[model samples]
Target: MVSKAMHRIDQQVPVLPIGDGVARSARQQQRSPYLYTDDEIQRILHAALLYPSPKASWRPVTLFTMLVLAYCAGLRGGEVARLMLGDVDLREQTLEIRETKFFKNRRLPLAPGVMTSLKHYLVVREQAGAPTNPESPLFWSPQRNCGYTVGGIRLILTDVLRRADIKPARGAVGPRVHDLRHTMVGHRMRDWYKAGINPQSKLPYLATYLGHKDIRSTLVYLNITPGLLQDACERFRKNGAAAPQTRESLP
Candidate 1:
């Protein structure tokens, strides 16, 4: 197998970094990521929490927990699906995301409300008699008897979005479930900018939290709009021409 051959070669000689090996095609412009508004996010969560039940299924709690984590932590759907019981520390209010995209591990802290929901889910899960072993999946499926799959989670999210009446922009490609991660970053930047904080100074922290390889990757998630531009112009005027250029105005 190629993997075995690569392993054997690696043992004999250090493997050379081949890079991604894909050629970048020149495009007219970068595709913008879709961002969710606060009301839409609330509706989405409400729909997820109200996922229809046979009156006893744990699907509602599982879906709710998954959505909250994805939005708050900027986690990829697969990362949420792959979480294990040992990865979550309710006491510490942190999640250990292990061996994720780019072969990196990171720690994600939960918001207080999110942690409360997780604790409530855990209580429900325990009462339902789901396995609580460290290696067991943190988000388990009662019917499938396994951890939630990426496809499964996607389907649920799609359904939740539909129920919430959140639609993609006319002729736009996205508003994909993964856009929740984009929304988190974009919203954070907007908040910082509105607060007169320099978002550029905090880019690295956001990059680390989102498990991006570098700030360049983080920058791809930011989309400048007329509103952001207007805010920057207003801030400049307020500062009497001494205002620093904001990250939003950077090329």
Candidate 2:
């Protein structure tokens, strides 16, 4: 714009063409998400539970519970970090995720097992002298006396992943904290297939549960895996044979 104005003011001024000869940079390929198996998830959780820290007694349990919520509830790391005490309702078995990505708010029903785990964590959190006020962070950092930051959550999870032998000690290539969300989606779809349910029909519900603006956004997480493929293939085989077939005469 400055160049254009200068050229307008002075006929002698040359407005060199911008981006005329420049080649557009190639779009970087997005890394394939690592879909975690049930055993791998258990290992990661176990590593978190055993994470040793002398100053913060609540660290181990806090990390464990956070991972559980991330994987089981398909929560984004920020959503997990931003949870307030009042957001969780043990009696109702629900979690109220406040303003998140795209400035959206959502409430999610917790599975019974997840609720039980959370209840156990709450007991531990209270024992550790965490503030019980409704506004206080659910996953409090005793050292900081505040909620864990999104970056902090990722770093901690990375360390746990290393301990669990799920990732290299020093590298960017590994199962990320965000992969838990993908894993949750993949696992849920696989389960639906095994149960003889139509996963396509359930996509919108999953999208809403994950706080996605639309099913298209949710579709990115549904990477085909061996187990999911097997179940899907089985479903197709059984249903394909029974599907009504019509004969059409050729012109």
Candidate 3:
């Protein structure tokens, strides 16, 4: 009998990519690393404005107003829900943001459109038989016979997001109600840069606008690099050249 030659069978092994970067990138996509982009934000706002609430006998008008106020005021959902008729100063074009987080309250200016939209809302609110007291909440559901709570506001946003197909991932994860507040601050910083405002110098103002007790909280929202980085680079280039040796010289 001839001895059979021993042969090795090749084992099936999966081919793996050489670099781990691809896997890392795939993991990162699973994470939300950035706020909504401008276009995405606009879509979000539009969807919010179009949200159909059972109590929206005015045809979702309150949803539109809420989105505008949330965007323009940088106000959190709690603050938005808590807003009262007298809190707004129509003549001064300012809103008195009261009893915010950290025991802080502040006054914030309003854009013309925000003021106008609110006035229009007030008209409809009166037509809908809203309470006559300025001390009462500005937002109340005729159907619910109560003011809109933070949960109510969140529900409206959640509904809108679902309708727009922009809802966050399930399992109690993803974007939050406060994200809109952060988004507004980010948008404000973007506009400030576009208008050539000194971001550092005006940080306090932003904090005040958002009713932040400290400037640091406000800075968290304006976390993007475009304005701050660009300003720093431009300032560096200018000072790199000879103008005044002493500090405190800028036009």
Candidate closest to the true structure, highest TM-score: 2
- Once fitted onto the true fold, the runs of candidate 3 whose alpha carbons sit more than 4 angstroms away are 1-34, 53-55, 169-171, 225-251
Worst 10 residues of 1 by lDDT: 20-29
lDDT of 3 by residue, 213-237 (tens): 7897776676665655676677657
Score candidate 2 by lDDT: 0.89
| Residue 228 Cα positional deviation in candidate 3, in Å, after optimal superposition | 7.1
Question: Pairs clashing in candidate 3?
Answer: none
TM-score, predicted candidate 3 vs. hidden true structure:
0.73
TM-score of each: 0.79, 0.85, 0.73
Evaluate residue 113 in candidate 2 and report its C-alpha lDDT on the 0 to 100 scale.
Answer: 90
Candidate order by lDDT, decreasing, is 2, 1, 3
lDDT of every model, 2 decimals: 0.81, 0.89, 0.71
lDDT of 1 by residue, 17-71 (tens): 4433321212213545678888989999998888897855777887888888888
Query: On TM-score, who's better, 1 or 3?
Result: 1
> Could you list the CA RMSD of all candidates, in the order they appear?
10.0, 6.4, 11.1
Candidate 2 least-lDDT 10 residues: 20-29
Error of 1 at 228 (Å): 2.9
